[model samples]
Target: MRDTGYSLRNAGCSLLPVRWGLFAVAILILAAPVAASGPTNPPNPTTVILVVGAPGQDEFGRVFAESARLWLQACEKGHAQSIAIG
Candidate 1:
């Protein structure tokens, strides 16, 4: 029961657990607005277009077809949504 001035049990302690608890509560209250302040508008979905044309010097159209297939795969994944071809 010695007065070390830092114990929560000491009524005269300047740094009590209650004081620390209040400090933490005050910090959380002040930070609540910041934590809740995200983008008011959510992200808009994206659109992508894949245009496949004649590969001038290619013996076959494999390159163009492969590129288009990759684009389709991207759309299938969550990375892309609406897609069109021209």
Candidate 2:
């Protein structure tokens, strides 16, 4: 039975498989879903309307900004969903 300083140092370090180490932790984190644990806030209901005449441009803008702002108060609103005139 030999008790050596090398054995003591080796005991302090990791001898188990590398996969069972920090790599496994990272794999678990990446594999986990990003969504929250509880029920989600629900996606905002966005509306898109195609415009033709010039008069409706103003109206479309108003409706898009208003409804989108109203329904999805805390959510991120996209300009593309709001208004587009052609």
Candidate 3:
């Protein structure tokens, strides 16, 4: 057989270290859940501040009011505090 300067043994040897490194990383990723299984505090509620701009026309004012109402409804649904300012 002609020596092609490339063989399975040489390729496998070069990749062995990389394979081991990847295996170690996989092990760490799998173990993260176990490390995170500790007592945790509940997160604080979020507050949303909705600012309505001055509408140039009556129609724009109505639209802004409706938008604010919708945002208030969503905040209530999400159990978040909301402050609406025009």
Candidate 4:
């Protein structure tokens, strides 16, 4: 009968779990700073640009109009200090 129990190959595989645990800990430590900080709001005095295609042209004009309307709402909500509509 051969001594097949606790071979060197099996010993090497046993270290896999420890290596993965250490890797997980390192990742959490590196991500601590980003996780601690909450979401950040955009800077004040933001300039909002609304570019629109020429009206009364085609279906694209309708899309541009809708986009412009949404941007106007954002601007009114204090999301931007000024808007340049073109």
Clashes of 1: 0
Clashing pairs in 3: none
Quantify all predictions' global Cα lDDT against the true fold.
Answer: 0.74, 0.57, 0.90, 0.79
Look at candidate 3 and tell me the lDDT of residue 7. Answer: 77
My TM-score estimates for the predictions, one after another, are: 0.49, 0.25, 0.50, 0.47
**Candidate 4 weakest ten by summed lDDT:** 77-86
Relative to the true structure, candidate 3 has a C-alpha RMSD (angstroms) of 8.5
Candidate 1 residue lDDT tens string, 14-49? 556778999999999999998899758666577777
Query: TM-score: which is higher, 1 or 4?
Result: 1
The C-alpha stretches of model 2 lying farther than 4 A from their native spots are 1-3, 8-20, 29-41, 54-86
Better of 3 and 4 by TM-score: 3
| TM-score: model 3 vs. ground truth | 0.50
lDDT of 2 by residue, 1-86 (tens): 78665763477865566558778888778767653365676655666554434335888767766655564443334533444444
Model 1: lDDT of residue 63: 78
Stretches of candidate 4 off by over 4 Å are: 1-13, 44-46, 49-74, 83-86
User: Model 2 TM-score?
Assistant: 0.25
Candidate 1's C-alpha runs over 4 A off are 1-11, 27-44, 57-60
Ranking by lDDT: 3, 4, 1, 2
lDDT of 3 at 77: 92
